[model samples]
Target: MAGILILYATIEGHTARVAERIAKGLRDKGYRVDLHRADPAGASLDLAGYEGVIVGASVHYGRHPGHLRALLRKHRAALAARRSAFFSVSLSARHKPAAAQRYVRKFLRRAGWQPQQAQTFAGALPYSKYPAWKRLLMLAFVGLAGGDTDMSRDYEYTDWDGVDRFADAFARPLDAI
Candidate 1:
């Protein structure tokens, strides 16, 4: 089986959910899947033998985890050699249709790595999960973007079906290869 590596950097678990769904979808399709977070202290999962890789990250203030960026920089060559995909989760993805896909350009430039497939998934506003500073920061940011500002509960906008389809698409190219 072609092992698939799914790496993510999450703040309030939306990106984690996306990673889980993608991993499960790939596994159900008969591929071995590895799930990991791009934290420096996390295990250095062996990506050498994987048949493919999918890197996911959620944006806060238009940036991803520096830890993930480091991994991408270190594994640039290896990732480029494999069947690879990149998915970025952000509130901006929930913007108007014309503005929704706006993050790819900045993300690509910041990550300095590109995959065969790239996707943008809507993220969440986990006000309840945030501390006071985070909550206020998000509120201000959300306000500027015409997003919900209530800090009572969390809000998620990820499209699950879209995630599954993306996984299938990634699997499609691997199957072809």
Candidate 2:
């Protein structure tokens, strides 16, 4: 069987971590998974070899990476021809579910690619990893959003169990086939 393709775009690295967890869940179910990082400079992707594909991206400032949107536009037909899913990672997913859903809707509408499955996963706030300006900015944002504001440490909001469930759901139809 052709393997499942797990492609992701991350800025602060949390989205990549989420993608890895999803890949692990699918692999545990006996699916071959290929994990690839989406390049911001636009890398060509061929989806013919994969039985299914899962695309993930982190939303920053209300937007997903432009290159990922471009990739979806370019590969929409190939992705449509196969089983596919999309998951969006963002801070809004943790505090504001509606906003998170809007992000996904906007992204899909702009890209013109609708996957068979879609989900929203809360992301992390890696305060320690950010530069001073970003850390302060995030601190203020978190404070206003009623989230963790401790800049000395990072906060993770992702639900691992949910990610596993999503992986299982994506694999079910393929397994049936």
Candidate 3:
């Protein structure tokens, strides 16, 4: 069996963590998986060897990473041809579900790629990791969203169970295909 590919683009690392969790879920199901970063600096990747692909990205400032967009555009056809899934990680998805749905739609529309499954996962706020300006900006956003404003401590809103369910569902398609 061809292995699965789990690719992600992360800004503050939450998306990377989410991707790892998804990979773990698939691995637990007895599937071989390759976890990779979607950064443009890395070597080129293709979908030829993968039975299925899972793509993930973190939303920052209401936008996903530019590299993710480019990768989606570059591989849309290959992705559409395979059993694939997409997940978006963002703080806004927890605060404002409707806007998060829009963000995902916009991303797919722009990339002209639609996967077989899609999910939205809440991301973490690592205040300690952000620079001063970003921390201040996030503080304001969190305040407006009625979220935790304690910059001294980080907050993680991702639901691990939901991630597990999504990963399992994605793997089911691989079995049928």
For all candidates in order, the CA lDDT equals 0.83, 0.91, 0.88
lDDT of 2 at 62: 88
The sequence of per-residue lDDT tens digits that candidate 1 reaches over residues 15-118 is: 99999999999999899898988775644546787989999998766666677776687778788789988998888888743444556656666667778998
Cα lDDT tens digits, model 2, 12-117, are 8998899999988888888899999999887989887799999999998889988899889988889889999999999999999999999999999899988999
Q: Which stretches of candidate 1 lie over 4 Å from their true place?
A: 41-45, 96-102
lDDT, residue 25, candidate 3: 84
In model 2, the clashing pairs are none
TM-score of each: 0.89, 0.97, 0.95
Worst 10 residues of 2 by lDDT: 40-49
Candidate 1 matches the true fold with a TM-score of 0.89
The TM-score, computed over Cα atoms with residue i paired to residue i, of candidate 2 is: 0.97
Error in Å for residue 99 of model 3: 0.6
Name the best candidate (by TM-score).
Answer: 2
Tens digits of per-residue lDDT, candidate 3, 1-177, equal 458999999877889999999998888888889999987664467888898999999888888877777778888888888888889999888989888888899998888898889899999999999999999999999999999999999899999999999998888767765
